[model samples]
Target: MKKENVVIITPCFNENTTVIAFLKQIEEVAGKLPFLFEVIVVDDCSSDQTLSMLQKFSFVSENITLTILPLRFNVGHQSAIYQGLLYAQHLDADKFIIMDSDGEDDPEAIAELVKFNDYDIVNVARGRRKESISFQISYYVYRFIFKIITGKILNFGNFCMIKKKVLETSCHTSFIHFAAHLSKQKVKSTSITFNRLKRIDGKSKMNLTSLVHHAFKSFVEYAEELLMVFLRIFILVILLFFGIIGVVLYKKLFTDEAILGWASTMTVNLFTAALVCVGFFVMGILLLNMISRRNQNKTEIFVKLAEKSELLNQN
Candidate 1:
């Protein structure tokens, strides 16, 4: 059998204090696995000592094949991950794995991820959360709202593996939201149970406000679907508005009884107003999507944030 080139991609910002230990754990775990593997770390331009530290670690590490990719500027976590995937594509990697640099995703889980060769994507489901009760509550609230709005439950995070073909298709999406993108594929991927580990170093970069922003950000990936839902609603309301108007007209023109009360009159007016309002909002959203797509040439945006490999450890 051929030895497939497996890759692990991580996006880091100010993780210098903890990334070495994280990489060490990955090295130890990877040594026990049989396939050819490489660790790809994308450093989202950080203010701390993380860049230098990764350089130093790369200089000394001999057990693992590591590549330190530093971005030209900070593009946030999702973009960083996307750039890493693009580089993996350049390297012709067979299996691409993505995880958080904060060490919340256990390195040991990599073994379980690759075992299922049949899956195009392997998503990790959080079996136990290590966050505080408040955080958990907030997460549940976000998940509940996500399901209510998009009809898809948000359970997984960045901890997942994608085959090269899946990765190619996924990069075309607006954002690298693993759960939402994989859900869009509807490919029947497999998932494994894993606990969310507490951060090994600094506090989480995302606060409640950022978390809310993150939750809503998934919509960018589902723009078409969201537009369809809104269009359906708008159409339904317009149809109902006409139906009610027809009913009211029938009562006034075709009925033999006396004119009806104000209830039917008010319903027609309110529904007409609602239909117009919905039409305006839906058109605005579609216009926004068009402008967004024009502004967002993902390949161009990510390419501008180019990566340079520092030879600080692997072969």
Candidate 2:
């Protein structure tokens, strides 16, 4: 029987110190699997030696192939992965896997992710993160807000194996947040819980500000749904405003308690505040709608400037 082609896409910015070890780990994992594996390392125009290191690296296993995609400019992690996926579209592959180049995304989980052929996508849900307390707190908060906004629980990152069809479907949409976008897909999917590992070398690239920005990007992926949610809230607030006015009028006309000037002033002030809130909500909804439209029309700009390095092993 012919072996299936499996492509793995990993994006890195300045991971020169840990990238080699990560690639070696991937190579070791690929050697044990029966499928033919191709690893695509997308370098986000690293200012350091990341691109050089990737270009010089060699794989020992015959089953593994290394393809390095160096972008013309730094397009961030999500876009880097998108570029990798776009590049992989031309390759003949059965399954595509996306994971972080840092050691945090355990290479061993690749085995577990690929075992299920019945599913179109198999994701590695984050069980426990080994980051600092503050980072953990912030991540939990982000997840909470994501649940409140998108109405979906996000337990997975960009660590999963996807079929070619899923890849094709995803390539059409904006991959602002890979896992979040994939979660919105209607494909057959399953997830396995796994503890996140620590980095192999150097400190984490993601800081508090970056985490917040990342969370915002994920929210952007669900802009349309979030807009609808806010619209409902806006409508409810308008109804409540009218209800309050009705109650005030009834208290003045029917109730024995006299509505003083202070009471009338307070009611006007409250309604004025509500009107401001309504204005803000309307602006927010408009912004979200614009973002949703922009995302839908987003073009694959990375394809034009990305340069592909030669495959590590010809044979």
Judged by TM-score, which candidate is best? 2
- lDDT per residue, candidate 1, 142-233, as tens digits? 88877766788678988999888888776665454556767778675878889988787746666778777787667655666666676676
Candidate 1: regions farther than 4 A off: 1-3, 59-63, 148-151, 172-176, 186-188, 255-269, 272-315
Error of 1 at 38 (Å): 1.1
Q: lDDT at 263 for candidate 2?
A: 56
TM-score of each: 0.83, 0.89
lDDT at residue 107 of model 1 (Cα atoms):
82
Give candidate 2's error at residue 209 in angstroms: 1.7
Candidates' C-alpha lDDT: 0.75, 0.82
TM match of model 2 to true structure: 0.89
Question: In lDDT terms, how accurate is model 2?
Answer: 0.82
Candidate 2, residue 258: CA error in Å?
Answer: 0.9
Residues forming the 10-long window of minimal summed lDDT in candidate 1: 306-315
lDDT of 1: 0.75
Where model 2 places Cα greater than 4 Å from the true spot, the runs are 253-256, 260-273, 296-315
